[model samples]
Target: MSDASARPKKEKERGKGAGAPRVTARRPTLGHKWLRYLQEVRHELSRTQWPSREEWIRATQVVFGLLIAVGIYIFVLDSALSFVIKGVLGFGR
Candidate 1:
């Protein structure tokens, strides 16, 4: 009874009939599509702002530092947990 319910019936009556077939999209050939995609990728890469060698080296160092820190934290935590588990189960013998 509301406008929302009545709008669909009106739209359906105005649109394609119930028996009309649906239209499908046609894709480009593989070779042409690949060439176009590569060109677009090159264009996008050219527009990108790349980091300098110094900046890249600094970023890599930071990443490695964090990785080592996390590795050490996990190693310590695992060792503690293993010790506790062995003590609780009396398996240290």
Candidate 2:
């Protein structure tokens, strides 16, 4: 390896008194953190492209149709399995 690659990286320096204790990074208060979050949310909201009502309705219908199809498939499979189970267990009686 090269000498540059073998050398260790230097860390960031913190200004503290020579005789005083070292100061660590401080976290923001709850209210200040919430305010900062709201600012970020508003900034993102300004850049969003909202879909039209008709587009939303069409998307909703597509999702609903897929859900209904899946539900019916599960119901049919469950009923078929139940019938098979009953037939197999009936010979014991």
Candidate 3:
């Protein structure tokens, strides 16, 4: 059975000698909703602490440095494995 607390007030009050509550709030239109969403995004972006050019460049360089290191390690590992496999299988190139 569904919990009574999970139901809306109008639904819960059904057959309970209570009237449905009148809604006083109006829903915003689609255009106004989009405008409000964009305004919120702009406000949040303004509040965000952005990284400086030097920090971004240093971070990018570190990422590239690690990328190159990983690539070199993988290449060396693959070469070593290939050499061992070829020797074991008596296959040469």
Question: Cα RMSD to native, each candidate?
Answer: 8.0, 7.6, 7.9
Model 2 lDDT per residue over 1-93, tens place:
899876655332233434675579889999999999999999999999999999999999999999999999999999988888889887424
For residues 15-77, write the lDDT of model 3, one tens digit per residue.
654566766988899999999999999999999999999999999999999999999999999
TM-scores for every candidate against the unseen true structure: 0.67, 0.65, 0.59
Order of models, best TM-score first: 1, 2, 3
- The regions of model 3 sitting more than 4 angstroms off are 1-35
What's the lDDT for all of these models?
A: 0.91, 0.85, 0.90
Candidate 2 Cα outliers beyond 4 Å, as residue runs: 1-27, 91-93
Question: 48-78, model 1: which lDDT tens digit per residue?
Answer: 9999999999999999999999999999999
The weakest ten consecutive residues by lDDT in model 3 span 11-20
What global local distance difference test value does model 2 have? Answer: 0.85
Query: How far does residue 75 in candidate 1 sit from its true spot (Å)?
Result: 0.5
C-alpha RMSD of candidate 2 = 7.6
- Runs with alpha carbons beyond 4 Å of true place in candidate 1: 1-27
Candidate 2 vs 3: which has more lDDT: 3
Best candidate per lDDT, number? 1
